[model samples]
Target: MWVKQISVFLENKSGRLAAVARLLADNGFNIRALSIADTSDFGILRLIVNDPARAYQVLKDAGFTVSETEVLAVEVPDRPGGLAGVLDLLHDTGINIEYLYAFVSKSGGNALVLLKVEALERAVEVLGANGIQVQDYHIVHQI
Candidate 1:
């Protein structure tokens, strides 16, 4: 399954992050997961929201630098080794993961992984062949 992620380039200044969040809130976007990679002068705000296209548009309209990226959303068991198992499958298939982050369900019984890969199609194929379910964009965006 492919999910759209919004990557926003932000300066290291107060209210910058809040402005972005407020824009999304005003546009009716509910963020599902978020991560920020920071540097001395700037940061990258990576987010997965309910409405990615709209979120991107909102950010763009607000004068924020943004980009849309396709990523994989995978469901793995909450128990130990579940994530490892999935990674092992990908590694065996020679799929290189660029980056990944996790979000847990309310019950803490499941873990959803947001993954960026070098080759999306091949990653999906290999993961699917290994009995790993790849969530559809529809389902992912809704969640």
Candidate 2:
């Protein structure tokens, strides 16, 4: 139904984020998408990588508090309003998106948007009912 995401606690200091990215990059983990929620002290770096298990291990081994979460990945047209259309649909259905980030899909003409919603099951059901496509694990892994 969705992909596993890595949430890394990072300090706001310079090079803290780079250290995490470098660790993943050096481990052959390809970052598909990422988002950062920051405050004055620290940040939560949400990441979708090629290998979630391995990525988690790498980060954990490096002494970082990392957690995995299930997130929805939706494929949309790579044009303007493509994202808006989906958001609008969700809004109209009373679904609230907590956060979202985009990634280039392996599927040529489409883009992947990783979303966190307030209600997981309900959101999926409503999105499907409204003709909005939600990506499964197999589809997301391919890209």
Candidate 3:
């Protein structure tokens, strides 16, 4: 299964990030997880929210650049070497991970990892075969 993630492009300046967060909060959207990758000029704010469609539209209406992406939310064991084990499986299967961020699940005991990978279908298959749980979008939304 694939999760819907929103990527918001933010200019590098003071209060830009807070302004975006305030907008989302005022719109009643709950942020499930987020990560930011930045350079000197701009940054990419990747977010898994309760409502992707509304988030995208609100951000666009506010004159922010936003886009949606299909990513995977995987259940990783919340124990030693859990993440390494998952990575090893992907590596052995030749699935390249472009980027990833993680958060502890509020309703579960496992850590949830949001991953962007090349060949999403193959990666899902490999993970499923290896007994890793790839979460559905609906489940993630509820989180």
Q: What TM-score against the true fold does each predicted structure earn?
A: 0.92, 0.90, 0.97
- RMSD values for the candidates in order, in angstroms, are 1.8, 1.6, 1.0
- The TM-score of candidate 1 is 0.92
Quick one: best TM-score, which candidate?
Answer: 3
Give per-residue lDDT, candidate 3, residue 60: 97
lDDT of 1 by residue, 1-143 (tens): 58999999999999999999898988888888888989999999999998888888889988999999999988887789989999999988888888898754422356789899979999888888887777789877776
- Global Cα lDDT for candidate 2: 0.85
Better of 2 and 3 by TM-score: 3
Give the TM-score (vs. native) of candidate 3.
0.97
Top lDDT prediction, candidate number: 3
> lDDT of model 2 at residue 139?
63
Estimate, for each residue in 1-143, the C-alpha lDDT of model 3 and write its tens digit.
78999999999999999999999999999989999999999999999998799899999999999999999998998899999999999999888999999854643778899999979999999999999899999999888
| lDDT by residue (tens digit), candidate 2, 18-104 | 999898888888888789999999999999887788889999999999999999998777889988888888899888888998866
Q: Which residue window of length 10 is worst by lDDT in model 3?
A: 102-111
Over 4 Å off, model 3: 104-107
